[model samples]
Target: MTSSGIARPAGGAARAVTRTLSDDPLGGTVRRTVLPSGLRVLTEAIPAMRSVSFGIWVAVGSRDETGPQAGAAHFLEHLLFKGTNKRGALEISSEIEAVGGETNAFTTKEYTCYYARVLDEDLPLAIDVMCDLVADSVLAAPDVETERGVILEEIAMHDDEPGDEVHDLFARAVYGDHPLGRLISGTEETVTPMTRRQIQSFYRRRYTAPQIVIAAAGNLDHAAVVKLVRQALRGTPLDTDPAAPAPHRSATPAVRTRPAATVVEPKETEQAHVILGCPGIDRLDERRFALGVLNNVLGGGMSSRLFQEIREQRGLAYSVYSYASQYADSGLFAVYAGCAPGKVDEVLDLTRAELARVAATGITEAELARGKGMSKGSFVLGLEDTGSRMSRLAKGELLYGNLMPVDELLARVDAVTLDDVNALAADLLGRPMSLAVVGPFDESAFAAR
Candidate 1:
């Protein structure tokens, strides 16, 4: 019932609340506790920093939606910003921005997060505003209509951006026709017909105590955070587990086809946008580190193979590279390029060959070492920011049940071997490729090429 206690969660699902209580010497210790109502509080104190960032993470997103409620999770995210009984949308914005702080929310396939960042003394205020947004949004009709238009425009913007469009297309090509294939923002047609009642129903079901994670980092006390979470979450009851949907069945791999050198809409833009992708491993896969290293050597940065081959060696494109994106259940490893329209085929062939070469030849010791070094350096650099640390902890709590200390993750990254990268390249990038392209060309040219 209090901040420090040991109680077994019914059905053994409550172990996430049980963590060693110790002072985190690098900054502040991470502490976990469960409220009587079942909410989980995760707090990390970084006294060296002057600002605090805390987030309320709900373990639900697009993957949870059924056919009719395809975009309801994202819809609820917008409605939460509309207003609460005590504050309107404008008031909420003014209040947060007034403090020289920032507030925002995002919806993904597996989670919806609302967070705020402010000076240390303003932690309470940030917490209060986030609590209001998450648990008390009014979802008024006027605001609903207004936000619908805003979301529609957001969708249009993404559709018009070739790079963004290619990523979406890649997801479809990789995941098949499952819910994962659709964009997180949903289509305009889907958003247009959504109603307030639908948003409320989805919100009430998914935003429950047991499923929520409250994480804070910066100058703060763990006990104070536990108190705020307990008070704010007092009467919310947990929803019974929803029936698990049938597994998303992917269609048989499509034949490898050259991406159509075409633009969906001809634009008077100076540069042509392009994206290439391959099916990737899931988040929990052991090969994640290898894939990350592969991405680093292939297209992660200036030193990556894709950059060297596509830009530095050939001077064919201004930008070109590869990276990996993983979700709760699956992933996509992709390469992207922006070049002159005339250079489309040349760039595509170069990218494809680079991918194929890595798969066949495997990475050398120097290449693997640099990839690991880059991955390690980026991970360490990310921790230098309080906000990034806070996010890392919050997401880790949601995904791994406990935070893997920075050292533990880096050690794993360091342990990756050349053999690992080779197998990863073969399993993921080397196989039959699925193509997605957008530019001033036609599908036939890609198929024929």
Candidate 2:
């Protein structure tokens, strides 16, 4: 409740409040408005852009699901578009498409977003359709069963993709049975048995006004956007008693992880998928910038140490990279390689050597500079579109509870020193790591390797 986000009463009626959060010469002006219903609307008005991306972001994801409600969040996302009191499923899609626009939704480990990208002139239409689907969904029984079959098939298709499945295996290896380790799409056991009533209850209980944010970017007026959102949500579940937006997810009690263990899934695949990693810092960690620099040097790109040594020099693997995934209180840093079955050990050895070398002696000054450039260039380039800009606004509020200026973000990266990267490497890369492999090997095959 006491955070950098919009301050409001924890209970009772909250008055509508608006403020200009930022004014950039090139990025347009960013503004925020918190409605009496506790629904927060944020916008970045880039008049030169002919497209506007509107989204309704909920602060709920697979991480918030109970065991019985494993995939409930994602399932609910699909059913919302099935129908609402005001429009049917076809109407929802047809209306948006009719205007040369596109609308879609996705669920993540920490949040869910339902969004539409339309011509600037059709901003009002985008707001209404997006608002209607989120606020007034009628989760019919028939629709639940239909989507059930679709999701099961999706799960099956995912299983066939060993490349993707390896990441899930690594998550399980790290978090054990924690919700963070579970798949965003609940498995068949959970989805097949899920009932309409159960999902409906989950929806009403979780999607509260205080837990939602509406974000838009592109050519539009912030005030007009807020008004359209209010009108669209006039008589719905979200238009209830007002309260302060819920604080960012609590990070007090850190998420516990499993001991270092190697898990091998023996499947007869052409190439083996492998990930070697250990627990990393959380999103709030002060050393996150250092970690970013280290990750880039380690395996973030083609010129990265791992890529240069493994793929370019020996040609043992076609794909090799390292990444870090951060959550509210816990995170992961891992290296992935897809190689021929016979080359798995060599690949692992090379990867391990690179990690140990970096851990023992930090990267050179040249590597650090290149890493910084890559980090900064990628970030600035990613925001070239309205959707990315809109996402930045929602994530700032839902995840961090404050919009950090672009300059500040760049400065943070710029401030990372050689010692900072080296210190983080010595600490993080030196930690015990777990191994996950999806390949033609027995369970005992990887215990020693």
Candidate 3:
């Protein structure tokens, strides 16, 4: 993929500039446009597709919140859909459903996304509703109170799922008081007393046009989608004084502060959920592709080492996997297993032994090839839908500031030599690890084990 000219408005007035970021060897094309207000719009046009996935990706998330503002980003997500100046909650859903489309939003550690998937012909409606909800939400008081109850219940639901809660506990065990380690949904303590004014302030301060990217993928024209977005946001708060788009998030050295080495939440569950890991590389690390390959070899799938030994061989655990979470400036890599409370020690031991073996001797050539193949195939197969494509456009602009083509990405994975994977494994997996466990045991349960 290569690009040509970027036509900025002649006078740099209250207008927009357009650029062709890339053109696939095939007929596919990806484009980027910067609005006068600094809001960005990126799109990939796939003419053969019959549906469109359009989204508004805000660069603010739970990590942007203060202690008192924990979950404020997520709170605003629910409130935005509750009602906007131009549409009520019922109208918002009914309008999308009327066209056989679906809409939803999710908040993460560093960003939030509100999206709609609809028939190609319904792009205009989808664009308008999304823009309105994102930029013109009234954030009424009554809606805040109502959504507060909803979010509290959501938090409760998350707590009941130990499998999911274990991951959050692992994060805390590694990062401690860092914002990145906090729960995205905040706890009942933070959410209960959080005031509407606090959330509203965060909304206005961080939800600026400069920090947002609007992306869409479908059988559509770039210019028309840009026009629709500009029109929808014409008089809203987002279309204010002209400014340049915000640069991608900056990275800083994340300090771990020697967080608790072991965190166990005593519960009465039949199965014990645990994660053993250490801090890993950042998203921009040059070794990321190698790490992906190494992850697959370690515990990425059913054929992975951990899964085969833990589940298929000894039947010590019903589920086992390893995953890496990368953020702008920091990351964590961990192995997780859910097993009978009695077998927790055995599972942990096997996981540690496997991790140590990989770190010491590295993966074989055969294992390396399989790992690379798995990594490449998963990356390509994941983009077989409009939603994933749309997400690629948004994330490219919001996180990396440039789009890497599918072929280039695959090539990166293939370029992972055995040396690369082994070096990363030695450096990453050789580090001291922390452990988090949630099960029917006292805090001292894992103290000895």
What local distance difference test score does each model get?
Answer: 0.75, 0.92, 0.90
In candidate 2 the C-alpha lDDT for residue 98 amounts to: 100
Per-model TM against the reference: 0.88, 0.97, 0.97
Clashes of 1: 6
Ranking of models by TM-score: 2, 3, 1
Ordered by lDDT, highest first, the candidates read 2, 3, 1
Model 2 C-alpha lDDT per residue in residues 1-449, reported as the tens digit of each score: 12323445677435688888889764989999888767789999999999999999999999999888899999999999999999999999999999999999999999999999999999999899999999989999999999999899999999999999999999999998899999999999899999999999989998998899999999999989988888898888888875777888988799999999898888999999999999999998999988989999999999999999999999999999999999999999999999999999999999999999999999999999999999999989999999999999999999888898899899999999999999999999999999999999987877676
Tell me the deviation in Å of residue 286 in model 1.
1.0
lDDT of 3 by residue, 96-168 (tens): 9999999999999999999999999999999999999999998999999999999999999999999999999
The reply for model 2, stretches above 4 Å from the true place, is 1-14
Pick the lDDT winner. Answer: 2
Q: Backbone collision count in every prediction?
A: 6, 0, 0
Residue 420 C-alpha lDDT in model 2: 96
Give the poorly placed runs of model 1, Cα more than 4 Å off.
1-18, 21-27, 235-270
